[model samples]
Target chain A: MAVLPNAGADALLMTPTPLADWLVVAPAVLPLLVGAFLIIVRKRLHWQAPVAITTLALVSLASIALLARVWSEGTLVMTMGRWLPPFGISFTVDLLGALFAVANSLIALGCAISASRRVIRSSRRYGYFAFLVLTAAGVNGTFTTGDIFNMYVWFEVFLISSFGLLVVGSTRAQLDGTMKYGVLNLIGTTLFLIATGLLYGIVGTLNMADIMRKLPLIEAAPLMTLATLYLLAFGMKAAAFPVHAWLPASYHTPENATSAYFGGVLTKVGVYALFRVLVMMFPVQLLELQTVVAWVAGSTMMLGALGALAQNDLRRMVGFQVILGVGVMMAGLAIGSAPGLAGGIFYALHSMVAISAAYLLVGVIERRSGSASLNALGGLWKDVPLLGAIAFVLVLSLGGLPPGSGLWPKVMLVQAALEAGRGWLTAAVLVSSLLSVIALGRFFLLTFWRPSSTESRSKHDGTPRVLGVLTVVAIVMGLYPEPFVAAAVRASDGLLDPAAYINAVFGEQG
Target chain B: MKTLIFRTVAPYLTALMLLFSVFILLRGHNEPGGGFIGGLIAASAFAIYGIAFGVPATRRAMWFHPIAIAGTGLLIAALSGLTGLFSGTPLLTGVWTKSPIIGFDISNVIIFDIGVYLVVAGAVSSIALALESTEDNH
Candidate 1:
C-alpha cells in the first residue's frame, strides 16, 4: 500500500501508524544481521557465498521498492524508538537518498557476485563476506539516515569494516596500504565527528531536516565555520585534491574484489553526505565556499587524470580514475545550481556502476594475462574477444564518451556550468574528460588491442554475469537517459527545496 | 610478570569481577551502570585471568571462539530490536512487560543491553587474548 498521498495533500489523511515504515530500515538492517551471522559461521565456506549474494539481492530489491515508494509518495519518514522527530532518529527517504541507496546496493551486489568467484577460500573463512555486508550496511545507513550524528556513526561502521576488507589477504603491501588508508580515514572520521559535535552545539539538533530549518535562523559566522569544517572532513573522505593521496596509495593494495567494491560504492558516501549536509542544510554557506570547491574540483580532475596516465598498475590507475569521478561530481557541486546538483547526482550514480565495472574488468584482464602492468600486458582482443569488448565499453564509460553512462552527466555538468556562467568549471569538466579519454583509451589500446608481450595465465571458465549487467546499464543510460535524468533532476529539486523532507519528518509522527 | 601471589589471587578476583559485571548489567536500566561498563569489567576479568593462567587456558574456559561469541551477541541484539514489531511499534522501540515468574519489570531494552554486554565482553576478550597469545609467541 502507498505510505501517503502526494505532496500538498490534506494532512488529515496522514496515518499515525505507517504500515510500511519497516521498509525504511530494511536496507541498513538486513545486511548487518546477515553480516553478523556470517561472522558466526565464518568457518563454513559453503554458506557464505550463497547467503551474502541472496542478502544483497534482497537489499537491492528493498531499495528499489523504497525508490518507487518515495517516487510516488514524495518522501517517506520513519523514526526509531517511538520518539518524536526532534528527539528520535529519523530515516528519511527522499528521491536523492533512495536513488543513491539503490545505486549503492546494486554496485555492492555486483561486487559480491565477483567476490564469490574471485576471493579465495581462506579470505572467506576470515570473514570476507561479513566485512562486505557490514560495509553495505554502513553505506546504506549513511544514505538513508536523516540525522548528522547518525551519519557519523554510519561512517565509523563502514570505516572499520572497510579496514577489515582491505587487510583480508594480510600481505605486506596490504598491511602498508591498510595502514595508510586507516590513519588518514580515521583522521577524516575524527574531523567529521568534531564537526558534527560543533554543529550540534550551535544548532542544538543533529537531525538533517531540523538543521536545514534551524540553520537560517542561527548566526551566519558559526554556520560558515561549521560548513568549512564539514567541507574539509567530507572533502578528505571523498578524496578531493590534496587529501586524495591515500586513495591511490591504498585502494590497489587489497584484493581486486575489495578494490572493486571500494571503487564502486564507498567514497560516494562522502559525496552524498556533502550533498545532504552542505547543499541541503547550509545553502548560504555552500554559496560562500563555492570558489574553494571549484578550485578543489578542478585540480582534483587534472591531477587524477595525470596520475592515472602515470600508473603502471591497473588497480592504481582505476583508483585515480575513481578520484577523477569525484572531481566531476565536485564540479557539479561547485556549480551549486539545480541542474548542477542533478549533474553531480547523475555522475555519482553512473560512477558507482562504471568504476566498479572498470575494476572488475581489470581484475579479469589481470587474471587472464597474469599481470596488471600496462607495459607488460597486451593482446586481449586477439586472445579473448569478449573481455576486449567489456574493456572497450568500460574505457568509453570512464572516458565520458558518447556510448556509455558517463556522457549525460558530463553534458549536464558542462551545460549547467555554462548556464551558470562558470567558465573554469566548464573547462575543467571538458578537460578532465579529454584527459580521462587519453589515459583510459591508452589503457584499452595497450592492454587489449596491441599484440601480446607474455603468455596468458591459466584461463578461468567464465566471468561473473554482473559485469555484463553493469555494462548494459551503462549503455542504456547513455543511449536513453531520459528516466535517469528525470530522477536526478527531481532529486536535485528535493535537495534544493527540502520542505517535503522536513514535512515528512516533522509533520507525520506518532 | 606472573608473580606467585598475583597468580594465586587471580581466580577469585576474576570470579568476583564476573559476578559484579552481571550485577552492573542488570542494574543498568535504572542506574548508572550498563552493558558497556559491565562488559568492560567482565573483559578485564578475562584479561587478568589470561595474564595469570595463560591464553590457552582462558580459551579453554570460555569454550567458544571470542569472535563467534561476539557474532552471537550481535545477532541477539539485532533480533531484540525486532521485538517492537510484535507490538506494532517501530524497530528498536523498547517493549516492556511484567515478568510473571520473576515478579519484576523487563523489556527488550534489557535484552538488548545483555546483547551489548556479550558483544563487548566477547570482542574485548578476543583482542586481549590475541595480544597475550602473540606475546607468548614472541
Candidate 2:
C-alpha cells in the first residue's frame, strides 16, 4: 500500500522551526488515518474486538494532549516535515480549533464505547462504526486546518464517512433519507468546490494566510460576493433553515449512537468553517455584508426553533433544536464584536456537546420505552434516574438556562447586538432565544415528564456504561469551560489577525 | 452465461482496473487525472466485476468501501491545506517552486491534486456501492 504523505518532511520536523506547529495538527487527524486503515483491513483482521475501542481511546487521548498543548502554549504551528507554509501542508492548532478537536474526539470516543455493544451484535456494524469515527476524525481535522483547499478536502472527508454512517442500516426509511441527504449534500459540496476554485482563481493562492495577505489588497466586490457564496454553501451544510431539509430526515435514520455523535458533531464543522472564513480570512468582507447576515440569522433562529417546537419525534425535535442554535450563533456573528464572536463560538461549542448528549440519552429512551415518539413515551425521571438527571442538565444547557455556558454566550450576543448599534437586532436575538427556550422546554416536558398512553413504571435503567461516560464529560464541560473558552478566544484572535497567518505561510514558504 | 464474463474476463479486468487506478493517481498532479477520476474508474471496474461475478466475488478481491478510502484521502488532502497556517498563509494557499526538478516546476499542488483524485474516486465508488447494496436488499 502507498504510504500516506502525512509523513512529510515538515510534519516530521516539528521543532523550533515553523514546522513544530504541525505537531498540533496530528491530534485531530491521526484517528481517521489509523481508523480508515483498520476499517479497510477489517475483513482480514482476526480480532475485531479492540479495533473500534482501542482506536477511539487512542484518538481521544491524542485530542486531549492536543488541547493541553494549545492551552499551555498560545497557538501551535506544526509544519509537515519542517516544510514552510504556502509550500507544504501544515496542521496548525489555535485554542478554539484544538479545544473542539479534542472535545469532538472525546465525544466520539464516548460514542464508540457505547456503540461497542451495538456493533458486536451486527457483524457489519464495525465497518459502519469505523465510518462514524472517521467522520469525527474529519470533523476535528477540518476545524484545525487553516488552508482553504484542505478545509474543502476535509469537508468531503466528513461527507463521505457520514454518508456511509447515515445509510448503514439501509432500511426503507434509511434509504429514502440517505438519498435525499446524498443529493442535497452533494449539491452543497459542489457549490463549496465552486467557491474554493473561484477563490483560488481570484487570489491565485489556496493557503489561508496567502489569501489574507492578498484579500485586503484586492478590490473586487464580485470576488467578495463569490466568497460569500461559499459561506452560504457551508451554511446550507450547517442546515440553516431554508436549505436544511436533509437534517431532520437523515439524522434519525441511524441508531442512537450516530444521532449522538454524527448529528451532534457534523453541522458544527460547517458552522466552524463559516466562522473561520468570516472572522479569519475575510472579516472586512463579512462585515460589509453584516446586515444581510443579521436578518438571515434572526429569521433562521425563529424558523429552526419553531420547527423544533412542532416536531413530535425525540430525535427530530433535538435535530431542529440544533439548527435553532445555528441560527442563534449566526445572529451572534452578525452582531460582530469581541463578545459577539465569543458568544457565537461558545454557543457553537455548547450546541455540539449538548445535542450529542441529548441524542445519546434519546437512544436510551428508545432502548427502554421501545419508542422515541412524544406520543409514545414519558416518565423517564421516575424510571431512569441517571439518564433523566443527565438529560435534564444537558437539555437545560441547550435551552440556555442561567449560570450555564449557554447563558454567557447569550449575554455576549446581547452585548454584540448593542455594539452593532442595531437595537432591533438585539431585540430579535432576545426574542429568538426566548422562543428556543420554550421549544426545547416543551420537548423536555413532553418527552421526559408527560406520561405517554403506555407509560410504564419499569425502566430499562441499565444505560450502557459508555453513555454514562459521555454524559459525565458533557456535564463537566458545561460546568468548567475555561479551558475551552480560552481556546476559542485564541482561535478567534488568530481568526481576526490574518497578517500573522499570511506571514506564517508566505514569509516561510514563499 | 453472465458467469462467463466472471470466469475469464473479470479477473483480468479487475487487475487491470486496480493498476490503472494507481496510474491515474500518480499522474493526476501533472495532468487532469487524479483521485476522483481514478477512484471512479476503479469503482466502475469493481461494479463491472460485481455484475459479471457477484458483489461477494468483487469484494473478495477488494477491501474497504470506496467512500472510506475517500474519507481518509479527504483527511490527508485537508491536512495539506492547513500546513499553511504554520507558514502564515490563509488556509489552502498553494506554493509553487520554480526550482528545477532537473529543470521543471515542482509544486505542492500535486498533493492537492492527489486529494482530488481520492475524493472523486471514493465518492463515486461509494455512491455506486450504496446504490448496489440498496438494490440488492430490495
Which one wins on TM-score?
A: 1
Reference-based lDDT, residue A188, model 1: 92
Model 2 chain A: ten consecutive residues of lowest lDDT:
A1-10
TM-score of each: 0.96, 0.81
TM-score of chain A of 2: 0.90
User: A115-217 in candidate 2: lDDT tens per residue?
Assistant: 6666543534446666766787778778777678888888887887788777776678888888988899989989988888888888887767667777778
Estimate, for each residue in A1-510, the C-alpha lDDT of model 1 and write its tens digit.
112223342222223445577889999999999998999999999899899999999999999999999999889878887677767798888999999989988888888988998789889989999999999999999999998888899899899999999999899999999999999999998999998888888889988888888888876448888889899899989999889888998999898878988988888888998898889988998999999999999999998999998888999999999999999999989999999999999999999989988888888887878889998999888888887888888888889998989999999999999999999889988888898899998998999888887776648758658788889888998999999999999999999998888998888431
- C-alpha DockQ of every model: 0.49, 0.14
Off by over 4 Å in 1: A1-16, A508-510
Instruction: Flag regions of model 2 displaced more than 4 Å.
Output: A1-22, A44-49, A80-83, A448-452, A455-461, A464-485, A506-510, B1-138
Locate the minimum summed-lDDT window of 10 residues in model 1 chain A: A1-10
